[model samples]
Target: MIGSEKLVARGLGRSYGDAAVVRHGRTVLTERLDRFLQFDARTGVLECEAGVTINALIDHFLPLGFFPSVVPGTKHVTLGGAIAADVHGKNHHVAGAFSRHVRSFRLLTASGAELECSRANNADLFWATIGGMGLTGIITDVRLTLSPVPSPYVSVRYERASNIDDALELFHADDHRYAFSVAWIDCLSRGGSLGRAVLMRGDFAPNELLTARQRHDGSRRSPTPRLSVPGSAPQFVLATPLMRAFNAGYYHSHPGAPRTKVLSYEPFFFPLDKIRNWNRLYGRRGFLQYQCVLPSVGGREGLIRILEMISSSGSASFLAVLKRFGEGEPGQLLSFPRVGYTLALDLPNRGPEVFELLERLDALVVRFGGRVYLAKDARMRPETFRAMYPEFRTWLAIKNEVDPDWRFSSDLAVRLRLMD
Candidate 1:
């Protein structure tokens, strides 16, 4: 691939979509540039190379009573990628996106100059780059404010919701009482059982809340995943029937009343991380993650419509998640989160039919004023993207000013017609 009008910088290869890839040209890979530059133990600010992984930061600082303010589902994402996507966490209703915690970063622009972008300096560039999907510039280093933690464990609560209405009501009733919240939805369930979910809310556990044996050490560590997927999955492994059974089993495993427990941070936040190469379970065709957020104004009805459509189409989603977003980060031009509820699902690639189903879902999302998360996107059309991200034009204006040559681009950018 060569002679493309734009280029892209990629790290860790974590984005489920083509945001980190440039099919028409070579892409910049930044994994080897990783380095920890500095840290302020007093204020919990960390300075690290853009290539540094989220897990690296957690490994080095979680024991020190500090952690990244916002962590996406995976710990494999790079600092630059996280900032580029303006990643959010389960606590999005509270702490906001990762860009909100970023103090400053060194950006190498297309003009062959290094600019220090921050909330107070080069403010436009900062916001544009945060969620611009690496089209603004190549981030070299970052200074981010890390959150202080009482311990590596979390005080968790599990509450089961029987349907869409019940889930929404539970979120409304408990969001203000928890620091972190998320719901695992059963998308295949139809009729009265449609949108059944298990809601989990958590807060960092303090020393006083720890057991006697666990309190022996001042610093506790997050647990490693117990199992790993060894080989490629058989073709029929995650088929419709299996996925339905799995979903049913998972839902039935929950208790009737809200149960509280002290669990390690790893299990509480990243259950998918429990297995290595878990994506392989969907077989060689792989899978696609469709994540969309509907506006709070009419989200309930819109979500129900989407769910009913999915159920009627007989498309099974093995992993479906639902969460509420509080608000958009200030000046985050292309960030995905807003005042709404987000639903994310993993659809196994079964052929042309999968795309057809997604296209229908896209239409509904547009009808209800929602947008798909670009970080997890793989096949959204140009017009669909424009409708979802209303700030595309505004982001483009700043992108042209900073990258007049359109130096930063990705496959996702090209497919969405973000390039000139």
Candidate 2:
């Protein structure tokens, strides 16, 4: 099918955009391809089919002291999706993006050929496929290096920042002391409180830090109850007033002084996963997740301007996050992370107004030498994409060489003219 039809591989559908949707073309689901092919318990090296999910990895290997080297906001994402996005996590400041740990993968090209791709073999294809948004080819399976954790718990410390500058200072001062760090900003706040946030930093809990009962039971956590949104909510459910109230309450809930606690990995990392179908809260119009990274040079001013726009526009986004990135993967051309600060927000799709706000944000990001994350982007313009990712042409060269006919395509690829 790949040889003759325009196609894009879909796995778990976690991406916020149409990267996996081919529009009039075929969509191949990799879910059933799920399988674990190999494992090295001692070295934490494991090879698995593209369909294996972060959730699956945790369930199967957490008990054995291994976890994926990196994870996004959710664990439902498949390995193939992670590689395609080169997803990063709270530890990106240290561990880097997913591509850094990938050893290799088997690619099924459009020419009806299977190629073994890695940093040392078929190296160009290897770099292209990582963060290539699956446009290069179908990733059959992956050899990944899993990280060994001391336990399933994280020793987390929370500190409150009065504003953006405070938050950035806290991050810079302590990021190196922890393996993971992230901040939850109140985008609705303004004036003296603009960008006020609760910064959370953590590292895997060592045995000595675990409670007696926790240590006795391998620090396992009891199953927490899950909640699901039954149906689409009204569009006004996320009104500015309600969002402001929620943000205020959340900001004040955490004490001003820093506090520490040992928490299960679930709450610390995948808090939203506990509420299934949480996107339903955004109503039938859904939401757009805008994630962009601003280089360190002017990131603070950029963030302030961006937040001011969001706050002034009344397009309140309660799920606003901030994180610092170390550097880009050396040879991974299309990967998103760079040495800078990244901000992400969940904006309710309010038709023209919201989109217009995004366009302004995009322009600001570009002015600050930043780029939007393609994995979460849905409405970026072709010219804007070109400006953000100057390396796209290089990636395109490799794509043309491997799939010269442009057999692999997607709605996003077409919209961004990636094939052209």
Candidate 3:
């Protein structure tokens, strides 16, 4: 199908943008391709179809004391999407992106030829496809290395920071001791409270740390109570004042002193999963998730400027997160992570105003040597995209080599003129 027509392979449609949509072109859904092809229990290497989801991986393997080396905020994303985006997680400072653990994959090129790609075999194609956004080819199967853990629970420590500097200090002072680290920032806070956050850091819980019941529960898929937004919300649901209050309430709720607790992996990693259709909170127009990483050299100052802009703009973000990224994988040219601080903001889509605000944010990010996550972008200009990803030329060269006719394309690809 790919050889004869313009199309794009889609996994779970979890990407926030149109990376999976092809406009008038065909979309090949990989859901039916879901299957576990092979497994090496001793070494923890598992080969599975592209459609296999993080949720399935956890439900099946967590009981056996294994987990994907990296998982994004949600588990609904498929393995193919994870690789296409080179998704990172809370432990990025330690684990790097998902592509780092990928051993190899089978790619069906535009010519209908199946190529086995890895660091040592067809190496160029391997790195290209890692974060290539499915433009190079359709990924059929993947061999990945899973990390071993003592239990399914995570032992988490929470600390409150009065401002952005305090948060950075807390993270820099202790990031090496924890496997996972993230902070919930109050984007609406101003003055002395600007960038205030609650930092959560943790590692997999050891068996000795678990209670008798927890040991017996051991990776059992317990049913978590869920709530769903019944319908499209009113535009005022996320009004600036309401969001400001929510941010304040959340900030003051966390204890100022450090606190520790053992939590199931589900809540620790995917808190939003508990609220189904949470996006509905943003109303019928939806919301835009702008995520960017500033190089550590100027990251702190960049964050302050960015936060000040957001606060003054009055387009409050109901959900904001701050995290530190370690060095990036040299092989994945288009991958987003680097040694820096990344901030993600969930802003209500208020038409032109929101776009204008994002443009300003983009300029600041570029000035600070930062780049936005392609997986979450929907409205970035072509020139801005070029400015953020300097390796696009190299990635384009490989795309042209494997898919000269541009057989695989998406709304995102065309919007950014990726082929040009």
Candidate 4:
């Protein structure tokens, strides 16, 4: 978005903050850029327009024995957005973030010039764009190294952890054996019962692991409904009582039993993708996803402080996820990955009280040498943001070189003074 002032690079509009919204500014909707430019089945290397989504790629290539090397929970995100955020999946403990799998790409800057960036060439620009959040330029095309898969199905195993300590041991013990993994922690629990969790781990299934019917229809396309949230929902729908009930039911539904089942890529990676406009479920007030990663060294103490803060403040979140992330590429000045446990929470925007509590959480994050995910953040103080992303100065230097006039900007950029 930075180059040529065409400054908006949009994916599925899935980002839960003003980062993806242009407000009154000009925006470039990259969804229209969804098209495969090239593919090499042998090497599993593919090139596509910036707007290409993980879901679209699966539909066209799964039958050919290919899939994203690393994918977040949802496959609806665009290639450009993934790079901009340097998104990670459950397998992060093994493969790191998305940038690792990206070979190279072309970025169109405000001056109407297309520049190639990669580890060996334009290394600085490459790093800045990796996690620059689209501040340096718009991604016109992307070249990524895809991964070979056995079949489109994954063999999944679920294990329940009695508490936080058990969860840690289980994660460390089994992470290497599985290609992908994640744990759903019960953040609402208190005292000795706190941090109870469910661990889900899986690897792509081999041909012999599949049933006759699965092998035949491994390419079958799952129907995706096109729908948006209703204009409004009752404000009372997201009250504390209802949220607590929902959380309780969600926790027990996955009792952590071991089950080896053949699951398709769609259901395993993009369960939420099936529900279009699911955000509307939060109602007219909208919602906010507060996600942060704390370094493992001090992260434990920081997490306890953060959770305790949230519990004491009485903030309610319908969805909360905790995952361990491996080291990531150094580019993308503001990327959100490191050696730590990251947590993401979905809270209905209830007003000033919640924001106040979040501020406290931010303080704890800062104290623990952690940072929030810029892509998912809607509310954060400018000072805190600067402190969290030390590379901001380096990103600014490059952005200024490309967009000195500041034509490419978002509400987030303005709020954080990214263009100043």
TM-scores of the candidates are 0.96, 0.97, 0.98, 0.93
lDDT of 2 at 389: 92
Question: Which 10 successive residues of model 1 have the least lDDT summed?
Answer: 214-223
* Per-residue lDDT of candidate 2, residues 1-420 (tens digit): 334778899999999999999987899999988899999999888999999999988988999889889999999899999999999999999999998889999999998798999999999999999999999989999999999999988999999999989999999987999999999999999998889999999999998898987777663543544699999999777889989999999999999789999988888889999998999999999999999999999889999999899888979678999999998767978899999999999999888999999999999999999999999999999999999998898999999999898889999999998876
- Model 3 stretches with alpha carbons more than 4 Å out: 1-3, 222-225
Which tens-of-lDDT digit does each residue in 145-243 have in candidate 4?
888898988898877776677777787776788888887776666666566677778999999999999988886876766655656678778877776
- The regions of model 2 sitting more than 4 angstroms off are 1-3, 216-225
Evaluate model 4: give its TM-score. 0.93
The collision pairs in model 2 are none
Q: Looking at candidate 4, what is the lDDT of residue 405?
A: 74
Candidate 4 has its poorest 10 consecutive residues by lDDT at 1-10
Q: Which pairs of residues clash in candidate 1, taking residues 3 or more apart in a chain or in different chains? A: none
**Candidate 2: residue 248 lDDT (0-100):** 94
Q: Model 4: how far is 352 from its true place, Å?
A: 1.2
Each candidate: RMSD to true structure? Answer: 2.1, 1.5, 1.3, 2.3
On lDDT, the leading prediction is 2
Error of 3 at 299 (Å): 1.0
Q: Best to worst by TM-score, what's the order?
A: 3, 2, 1, 4
